[model samples]
Target: MIEPTAEPAVEARGLTKRFGSKLAVGGLDLRIEKGTVFGFIGPNGAGKSTTIRMLMGLLPMNGGDATVMGIDVRQRPEAVRRCVGYVPEQHLIYRWMRVKEVLWFCRQLHEAWNESLARELCQQFELSGQTKVRHLSKGMLAKLALIIALAPEPELLILDEPMAGLDPIIREEFLETVLQSFCRGGRTIFFSTHMLGDIQRLADSVGIIHDGRLLVHGSVADLLSRTKRVRLALERDELPAELPQGVIRTWRNRRECVLTITDCDSQKVQHLEDAAQVRVVEVLDVGLEDIFKDYIKGQREAI
Candidate 1:
């Protein structure tokens, strides 16, 4: 297990962005500790990419400040880029360049480029250095992009939907390679994706964003432990006038209702049972995916 440090690899304060009249990201504050695998999760067009771009200093923020590897992103973007490896959502490489040529070109840019690591990664991914970038398949392109990012031996890696579109087998293989090669070193990884399963598998901490706002951020264990699904078999056909305090969403039938709640415990359950006079059928632990869904659903309802 990778233990995080006191110093943050990435930190943002009241980060905001707007495109003319449209708000892309708004008042977002985030912190990612060193050596921690932090997953940035949200639905498509929920400002995940926008936030990442701002952090990478690729896009200018309209409000707030941020730092990457303790280098002020706004003032020293190039310095931040030097220390951070980023794989964008789109694989934007020269299509005409051969694999080896691409590697050589990137090697010239980064002072910390590791040739042996690059070669090893290429071999592991079954990439032929002779092949042109245009001829590579989608999975191969993804692999090549990752190889480029990893070859720099960066302190922090920021991946924006790196596994967006791939077969399950290929995705699993890619994730395994990432775990073996990158994560074992205790380097910080900040990746954004809508895939909950990937987040669950890769992240020690997760931040959920919706419609340009963060819903919650915490460790995976804390999230799973705090959020629960309470199944109740109601004594009568009707629900109580007021639901439980932490209830985010509720599903009901004639005789039963399931409450999706946060910060749930025995006391809260007992209180609900006493107030509503409903029998507690079960208090089940919720999965990460379900928890994410419930948060998203609750946010949508609020909007």
Candidate 2:
């Protein structure tokens, strides 16, 4: 059972990271509830990886504090590591170690290691004990990282670009495993990815970071319900080319006009239709990708 109002499994209060003259992450605050799939979306070099590293205590934060599983990550990095599992964007396992040896080594270090769970995971992922880590394909390597991280059953799992460099079939399998096995037991997942569709499908909440700052963070339903794409099928071509106020994006397709309206009520769409007097065919759902593009475009225009 999830503990509502429980202390966050992972908490960041005004976290900031800098590199000389550049600010990598600027005053970010985040709270990851227990037993949730929280997705982080941002382009490469947008500070997602930097933020993760800081949270993991691989890098020190310039300001603010981070706690993982109620332990201060900066002050007690090793203690936090004991309760947290991290899979980096790049594979970092020993290439010469066979799969069985690596698992055995992990079991030795992690106090919470469950041998039965490890063996079951190896079977589920189709990883052979005799296979050397160097001989495993990229997909297999990714799965192996996941297994190692999860065998100890850490309270918080941090995955950076976990789906990167994976084939389609492997990606699906990986996601299914995460949703079915990992989340089933009420573990919290902090996953970063550029795959908007997966985020939409898997995340209970999402945080969108852009250019070293957080743009928005909320539940998926709140974003979709708050942002909508208003599409109208015109009876004539006399409609105004200019979009209504609050419309972030507009597209015209010969007798039809599509407008992406932000933070508006459903009644607002009816008002727009009445003002235009156009036959409204349908109001299409706005996707996260389109919303992200429009947000970036608007930011560019503002500058």
TM-score list, all predictions: 0.93, 0.85
lDDT of each: 0.88, 0.84
lDDT of 2 by residue, 132-244 (tens): 99999999999999888888888789999999979899999888877765646768999999899999899888998877888778887788878877778887865654446
Residue lDDT tens for model 1, 156-224: 998999998888877887788777766468588899887888888889899999888888888988999
Candidate 1 collision pairs: none
lDDT of 2 at 139: 97
Model 1 vs. true fold: TM: 0.93
